[model samples]
Target chain A: MEQNIIVSVDVVLFTLSEGQLKIVLLRRERDPYAGQLALPGGYIHADKDRDSLASAERVLLNKTGLVSPYLEQLYTFSGGVRDPRGWSLSVAYYALVHESLLVPDAELRFELWPVAAVPDLPFDHNRIVDHAAKRLRDKSTYTSLPCHLLPELFTLTELQQTYEHILGVALDKSVFRRKLPELDFLEAVPDAIRQGKHRPAQLYRLRPDRRLTIFDKTV
Target chain B: MEQNIIVSVDVVLFTLSEGQLKIVLLRRERDPYAGQLALPGGYIHADKDRDSLASAERVLLNKTGLVSPYLEQLYTFSGGVRDPRGWSLSVAYYALVHESLLVPDAELRFELWPVAAVPDLPFDHNRIVDHAAKRLRDKSTYTSLPCHLLPELFTLTELQQTYEHILGVALDKSVFRRKLPELDFLEAVPDAIRQGKHRPAQLYRLRPDRRLTIFDKTV
Candidate 1:
């Protein structure tokens, strides 16, 4: 009866593509629900891994040939007969990476699906994705979390669009621009400008030092 | 090698007493640093429990003889050889209760210690307590979490005191009063006034419907 809880780590990796927030999902290779869609995850290697975060990173590196710039512990789903093997617990995680960061790998195939159109996933992955998406949007309101969803160099217009995409709402252009300076992480690139249909907009990149910054308070 | 990961739930129950935030702790009875101080917790009974939250509620009830008004999933601490009994994971939870509600249990002695003065605890319980305290303070800034630390019936001044105690800072009375109306949860109890040293101050209580209200934005 003791030590009966099996532990695993699942990563809900999110990225933006074609102006839509998408989740990277992989097909499960083994049984319980073979060939079904599921988050990239694997059993926690107690002997080799340092912690759940490390286990999650290892799983992502092994399964998707990509490394996320930002990964946070989302939640731990346990109990209930979710796993056919036995009663199991999964330390779930959510990671954010620019879609362009994904490197093609011949051994693994990953597909990006719009979060709104996600199909019924294996186990409770659909629930995990939904929870993670909510967290991302919630944190985006105050923190620099949305910056991770965009490339290193981007125009202010592109940054605003990324936020709008994740939030699923069109924000007021002036209000968003006014709040930009308060974020204090965007450093204007002197000569960089993106020629949009209307005019050239100044480009900015997240200051290297602010890559891991969480704003002290909501603006 | 399967089903080797041990899973448990730990509860960090906090309450206000003597105008200070205190945590409820229990002394261990067996081999795990026997007789040492630790957070109230127990192994998840897979056969009887529904999930980690249910397990936490059960443990709190059986050990402390009281139910928490607010219980949240704080964080999950896993991996590391913290547990001498092999690889184990504990889903840590933090709860809030009013001191008046605790009915002393002779068999199960529970003591409330100031959060800042907590002594070294057994296992990773010390780290769990610290993390939960930080989360409480962080959430207090945006949510109506300060309400949990106060009794069901309290004055506006008492409510402000509770917030000040948790935040460890002084607030402007007029500014606080101006923001009170926007909370939308405080209802004045007519004819119920506390005759203080100077004058009678009106009494108030959390509106029954908004007891669980979490403000949409920070004050």
Candidate 2:
């Protein structure tokens, strides 16, 4: 028996801006949900390469005019009734891009909102964003993923702020400092860096040899 | 605007048995392609809850004739051409259950195979399995998830075995043991227990305060 087939890709782009976490969203200019804020996405081609990662890159570049960055497959959305159109399946991906790196050209119309102020998204995209947010929060607790969203050689305070923003909790300064040394994944740089009106804080970069492992360590 | 609507859910049931990591899979009884080993799943009903987690539980319980154990949303599969019948999306969930607890009845014919022995699964299941396996491996490195598949108060050897099985690696016993003390998640019971012909091994249990966090501690 023949079956109708539909496939699409959506992106949840994350960035750190003005000491807060933000997400990239767009307003659709065409039909089928025009003017609604939605995660940028599109239909998949029949002859497209089977690599979902590559497909995500293609769609994101086409829609937002952004190129290669740290992208990972987030999840899939396939519910019979999720779409008003025919059978549609979406392969959703989450990307970490520096805010300064985002260059919105003429092709795309979008805005970046601090995660806390994000409005209602289109087509279950809110759920997708929530999932990515949870992953980001949980991952930061154990992995070096937060580093991707930060500037190179950031201060301990800056790093901690990113965690606090994602986790939504005030962390103990001393306790957080004690935990950093255990994370052999980070390497201290030669010079301390100053952020306006504050004492220069120690700068550190992600250790190259340190691969992210989801192993628990005593705090 | 009339799009064919199709939806499905696939389960990745994981268990630890005889010091090996195994997955539960079903042999297709009837289909456009029958007599093949595949994940147990089916279409979602419109009348059902919109929560994917709830829908996954309902579909998994129906297919396996088993109650819910520990289930986590893995990923969503939506590649337009993944389903030949039409555009279909499959929400996949990965679950961990004690092998002894699963009593698959006659209706749902399935076999438990080591992750290594699993054949090329149908559809994008191979990809799904790959993703779930990676998550399991990564999570096992630092979380209390492995303990969920083991009996209460298991020996360090058994715990190590579970790690080896999931990670597909022979970790140094001494190093592995040393690392345990660093992980506040495991607590040793006051009483030591002997199993088989070996000397009494320290029995350990999961610490209630130390829950599994889905983050990679880059050490």
Candidate 3:
């Protein structure tokens, strides 16, 4: 009876690097398709906590030696035939890490690939990444999830550029600025940050307490 | 190594009934929490298809005796000890079905519960449902996914009510009407649908050629 159940967790670590959305993938060291690039993941422990999110967190930390960042469930892959050996169930999670915060250790061996240029991943991971990418693009238009990937304080132009990169389209600057007041969840700082060669733009931070509900907003 | 792989699939089926959002659930028939209410799911087959989505589609049809409808990958649940028996992974999918399409067969036994008053579900399915509900609410704001739950030709009032029921809020009539045209995905039909108490309202349908894209007009 114990042999019938197999649980695993896969993590899709996302970050913005060099103006592109990148995902962290590992080259498997063990057999059963060793050296294939795939998401960092492993089997669940019977003695661990029952909560799926906590289990995903534990597996991620063990594999990459990284603590929690911005993690959320992506989707579950339960195919009668996903595993060659037997029936294995996998719960996939997507995480966003600020590019500045990523510190890869020597012991951890993985490569970060741009989402647009990633080759085929092993065991249906490509599909998982595709779904998460689409969700990220869709959610950014209506929710505050995208802010989690950015620095605490950012210029409106920087934020808009992030949106453009993910959505793969140029937006109207005038209309975009006109819609900012309706967000209500962004608060401008009294001081502005300056960059080279252009005028300093106002910096804004996410107002968690404001809790903007865009349930009816035009997406 | 043989003991490490375990996989499963869970499905969240959504339908509109009597102008309310409802979910399909099943009463457990076996041990490890017999008689408990849970999502209809089971172990993945090892030799069927390697794709997670295909696996989900196969399991969904087997358990519910239903064919394809509007389905999307929702989220994955992988906790180390979610299953008391052993390690198990679960991939979840969300499906939207029109009430008229559901064929209640004797082979499939389950109950439809209103989203507002769902009872305790087995494992982490309760949390899964909550996440799916939130996604449905948020997706309705920008995409045409919610239209899958409505008839081919529906009134604007019906569309608004569908949004209201899923969002759990009363939207302003004028504001919602104004936003519909901005979407550019809905086309008004020449015919009208009559409600019992109100004047005949114009009906509308989603444009087949206009695919949903996550792009800002200004960027």
Candidate 4:
């Protein structure tokens, strides 16, 4: 029997913009929900791409002129009812990028919608977004995953604020500050400080080798 | 482009035998590694299977007579060089089963090999086994995943030994017993005890409606 599964990759690119979680959505350029807002996705290139990850990278780069530093395979969704053409399977990926990377000069303009208030998307995309957001929230509580939402160098206050926004709970300032050093995933940047109206605060960055770190307990 | 990607599903069915982690492997019946030991896998029936999980369940049932209750979707592996027939992608799944469910009489007899000493397998099956074992071990520390490896009724000592066997560490007996109630995933069976020559010890099972639970700290 011949199999004709429509295999594709969808990316749920998340960023913290103005103290809110946002995801990038693009307008489809072809039929089957054409000109509608959906996640940046495309069919896997069998000849050009090496694998699904390469296909995801190519789709993100082509649809939005931004490259994500942290990308992970979220989950796969499939069924015949998901696609109007035929049976389809999507290997969804969730990526975290700094808001500063989304410049306003891309050839094809994409919209950044708040993850909390996203509209109805085509082809089971809303479900994908919800799954990705839940994953981001769940991992942010126990791992250093939320650090990707901030810029390269940031103050501890800004980092805590980012965590609070994602976790939706205010962590005790003293407890949070005390646990940072024990967690040991951050290091103060030499001679780096943020110039604000108040007294300057020291800036910190993730350790050189700690791309992603896990904690034995919730942070 | 005509996408000729061969999408398939492979299952890493894990069980505990002689206090060692083992996975089920089947001998391929057709060409392209015929008669070689490999993970139970088959092509996705585009017309018959609902999704990747359905395909995995079907493949596991056809290859092995037993059905696994705790099957989870693991990572996906894909590339051109994996399968000799053509470019292929495999959505891998890991399943946990109690040893009692596996009967000796089956149409196509399967072999159980310890995860640590598994010999060379066909079609990236060795890599799949390693990945499944790592996932199971990692989750065993903070989640109620190891409970699936034991029979319906088990003593606390049996459960703790299962954990120690999978984690490859000796946990303090008092500390292990204290954390079980706080985790609240297991409940003492109503007036049940293990028949033994010494004193009859209480038997426990996973709490009703608590299939899988995560803990803030390691159990």
Candidate 5:
């Protein structure tokens, strides 16, 4: 049996900015990879932490001073020699947050790098980020766009644009609108409208009853 | 930082028998939860094991003489005190195999239990099994039905029955058959046929080019 095996949680926090997907990375504070950029994460507290997800949440709050609106357990990477310190395993997580949440925070100790243009990251973080990005794109095709990435209220066109940006594809406006019926989580904001170039577009926000999961039914 | 944390890999291996979905379990051989039924697992061997998945595959081959046809990473379990040995984490995996692979080995130490009627499993094994069962059913609805669970060659009726058993629902025969064209994984076995009571049903096998993944396009 392997001795001295430590468990940690690494998070691939994702958001959209300038019409592109981005991930948040923090500079490592300790040796073994100090000064190198890596995903925001820390060791799980055996006595204090309730679970791996909680540990990841703690890492997020400590590094960025913001809370993720949507987070899920991604793959666990314990393949190669990721840690310079003996054998260790990291339970990775992927989270979604609105770009606006972090854009105004000048005190954040992390940098948001475009998903495609990410430089070399320490450990297996680059591989972890790649997996999470693929997961987000795959889910976006079937599930409703992550509302947390947008403002409190948005128009249908704006929602469609978000999906297009994440999926890296162009969707027909009419076809995309037709699928809105299946997304029962969205609720029309009464009397609220977004003035567009041609006319005022109706505004909608995710219903309070609906959780982050936009659709449960199979696509 | 939490010290003395151990990481292990637990596998929920699934197969079909007697038209029912079943999972394999082995009796524990150690203390803390000795003599109780539990998922086959062991501590990660950092010295020899290449990765967590490799540890899972090693455990499968060591405990059960047969190798799995399909295996996927499921959720990781790290809740309350699941182990008396202190804080530990299990990187769980779910595998699929044909029942015929194990039915011939009467000396195997594992027992097959229906997914719905799983008895009390020690150390969060039950929760892990529950999550794997739900994952199998969910994937069965949209994915390729895990053809590895069936013989190399099979009839459409036989394949549909496998789907029905895993999903616990009767699929419309015509509708189910009509969807096969989209699967593209199943290739007709040339000149092979299964003699039925009324007529002979054509046999089909997975195409060499197509891997296990059946569906790539959005539903």
Candidate 6:
């Protein structure tokens, strides 16, 4: 009575490059939609993978060549018509990394598309990208999720701009800084300062072991 | 080179009974774990099921004989050793309903286990239950998730009590009522009032299509 469903993992690797949110899409080297750029995905190897998470990590590593520091299980998209082969289930995950980590090489074979205007893609990949983008935007309002899109050491102004960019709003600097003490997700690098056009600003990084810090109020 | 992995759905249907959070479990009738009280779960028929959500709703309604309004995709649990029958995947979901809906019948073979002290269940069910309970508790602090455990019409005191019960803390009546205007999820039901020993409290129902409302700050 086995139904023989095809299982796979897809990663929506998101990065903020040039002040715009973008996701990585790799050209499928094999059929269903070969030679077309799609979300980095592949079939789950039940024998080699310890579980679905391991499968997702492996697929991301193989397709993107960068191990993301903040990978989360987004959602599971499944249906019969989503694939031509058979009934398929994509255990989708979303990852956040700085753009500097995605150094393009000769054989990387990947392209980045901004989340606002993702082009038509094969299967239900567009829908999966939309869902992942919405989750990131919604969570960034009250969590320290946007910090993942920034480099390790960043100034307070850069962090606030990251939040504002993801939220699509301008926040009052005083109000944003007021909530930072209680949020308590970032720690200043001792004596580290960035010299910009203005006076030097302290550089802060996410506190150790505080990856996804949720705040009581919106930033 | 098919893995022949088993795909299934498991539901952690929780309800508030006598101020306790409990989940429903059913006795398996077939082999592999016959007569063992486990989560209400079954294999997904790729031919008959539309999608994973449809499969989850079908399994819950068929096994429990009651439809839940607050069913949501909890998480996907998959591995090789969770089940004795080789590699498996279980797309888990969680549902919240009032205890009055669980009407016991002679033919229905099910039991309720309090989440606080769940016993040794079969096939990683205990772990699933723990995950669902944690999600509910954490979301209750910022979202109006616990309100689903109340009847259609309830008093503000009842709503606050429900939150307190799920959060495992005592909330001040004055502070909770102060946040009600900002929460704005409930509407007074047409001047309806409930008579009690001290005074009549106004009856309220959730505002139209306002399920799972998020608050700006903690109550």
DockQ of each: 0.51, 0.18, 0.37, 0.44, 0.50, 0.45
Query: Going through the candidates in order, what is the number of backbone clashes in each?
Result: 0, 19, 28, 0, 0, 0
Where is model 4 more than 4 Å wrong at Cα? Answer: A213-219, B213-219
Q: Candidate 2, residues A31-70: lDDT per residue as tens digits? A: 6688988888876654553445556778888777788446
TM-scores for all predictions: 0.94, 0.70, 0.75, 0.95, 0.93, 0.93
lDDT of 2: 0.74
DockQ-better candidate, 4 vs 6: 6
Fnat, one value per model: 0.65, 0.15, 0.60, 0.48, 0.56, 0.56
Q: What lDDT does each candidate get?
A: 0.83, 0.74, 0.74, 0.84, 0.81, 0.84
Question: Chain B in candidate 1 has what TM-score?
Answer: 0.92
Quality class of the docking in candidate 2, CAPRI style: incorrect
Candidate achieving the largest DockQ? 1
Which candidate achieves the best TM-score against the true structure?
Answer: 4
Expressed as tens digits, the lDDT of each residue in B1-219 for candidate 4 is 368899999999989888887888888889899998899999888899988888888998878876777888887877787888877888899888898787656586898888879989888888878778888888888887899999988998899999987887889999999898777888898889888987899999887688852110111
- Model 4: how far residue B204 lies from native, Å: 0.4
Candidate 1 DockQ vs. native = 0.51
Candidate 5 backbone collisions, by pair: none
lDDT of model 6, residue B89: 89
Error of 1 at B107 (Å): 0.9
* Candidate 6 lDDT tens digits, B22-51: 889888898888988899989888998888
